[model samples]
Target: MNVSQPGLSRSIALLEREVGAKVLERGRQGAQLNAMGTALIFHAEALEAILERAREDTLLRSLGLEGSVKLGVTPITAAGIVPRALEILVKAAPKIHVSVTEGLDSEIAEMLRRGHVDLVVSRIGGGSGYQELAEEELFRSDWGLITRPDHPIARRASVRLSDLRDVRWVLPAGGSAFRQQMERVFASSNLGWPTQSINTNSILAIKAIVMSTDCVSLMARELVGVEVAARRLCIIALKGVENQRPVGVMWRRNETLSPVAARVLEILRRISKDELAVRKRVELPKKGGRSVV
Candidate 1:
């Protein structure tokens, strides 16, 4: 903060030369970070956080457990699993501080590779392209189509993929895992993709759009279980389209997890087991009733 203008300029020039890119724009309005500079600052902050955590670990060793964990999670797990697990983590290890980043699988994987996050909770299959990471399945959830409770399709006894082709839909953008799964479902059903669709990566936006409009979207049951139970949304009864995906905790392979991270992981595993058991109970058929399974 006490840096002189000339010294700051020299530092910026040195960094630019090292990176071989102009990180800042100099003008009458003063120096401003360009896009590349902003990205560099973000990574630099992550590195600083890592160093701070290291310092905390070194100093807190004799005073019992006290450290920080940077965790990344996908939207569904962020909404469903992280809260419960974090609750347990806080109660068990009061001195441990946790930072959470919510993102898609690919985004979180990149963060893990860059050492930005200590661990990630994301989908485990379909060639995630993170060969340097290790993952353990936390739970499995089935994907299903969701719409407003009073939507016309929600009233039907059964819905088909073909029926969805003509409806407005909210879908994830291209190359995302959810989008790929939706494409596979369309291909398997021999139905054309929906022409009227809004593509986005925000789970909250998708849910809001689907619940307020005639649009429908696919999501993990666990993600929307609370909403469905509250009668805010309804799952379209579709046969032969059940797709189960495994969600899990992932960390860099060959690296030992920090004490706080390890403890948080343990809490997540226990919570996931309980969640799976609850899901199984909800999935079980009632007496003299047919089960979706």
Candidate 2:
């Protein structure tokens, strides 16, 4: 990289002028890239990789895999599965660099549509608005009620929707699919919704609130598996509250994926299959049964 302070300043000014937005933030410490600058850098890097591939196609082919992959992932998939898959990918193909964007399902799908990301790993369903995107089912996840390990309700043999009607709850945003499913379950059981509720989309914040307070929340079992295994969280076994969602990979419909992206997708598929097999072999506790590690 070459350095020219005056030229760099002029270039930055021109970019800001053309985009009608400030791309950088200047402060006491130093200049830093703002959101717009960060986005520009991401696209610039992708373009650079594309140019490099064009110049060294034969070399890259000989090397097998060498490029960048931009991935959009939902919070749960990012927390539970993506890291492990990335670790395996790095060991298998060190030259295939991966960049991940973690967000809600809708946000990631929009990113995919806008070409901000190469592919997305998220819960797929009808009316998702990305029907034109190609999808490959990876696995399925079921939702369950979760709370702190030592919460008073954690010791119950069985729980009911009516029993939870008055308890404090950490809920997803209103009108979201997860929230709607929970509400349907409560309604079907003839139970009123909780009056005391904290609505958020951040899985980490929800987990923190549940762990430190008495608030209970619904979450995918695999997403909270590590905490449950460590006895930090407990899943309430309530009958007739089954809610399963399909987890999958989504990409642009008519476009071919970059080699690195394709390889990463392959790794994710393999990991998903392995995880599903493991879950099947591990006997799950029955409804009204105590927590099992």
Which residue pairs of candidate 1 clash?
none
Query: For model 2, what is the error of residue 27's alpha carbon versus the real structure, in angstroms, after optimal superposition?
Result: 45
- lDDT for position 156 in model 2: 77
The C-alpha local distance difference test score for the whole of candidate 1 amounts to: 0.80
lDDT of 1 by residue, 1-293 (tens): 99998998899889999999999998999888899999898679757867876776677665675787889987778878888889888887787767899877889888887788899988887587767889999987776778887787776655678666678889888877777777888778887777889998777889989989999988787778778777787765567775657888999897789878898888888988887788768864322121222
CA shift at 122, candidate 1, in angstroms? 0.5
Q: What are the lDDT figures for the candidates, one per model? A: 0.80, 0.79
Residue 66, candidate 2: Cα error in Å is 1.8
Candidate 2 deviant stretches above 4 angstroms: 1-65, 175-177, 285-289
Per-residue alpha-carbon lDDT of candidate 2 for residues 158-243, written as tens digits (9 for 90 to 100)? 67676776689998777566677668777778777767899886677888899999999878887788888877888866766655
Sequence-dependent TM-score of model 2: 0.72
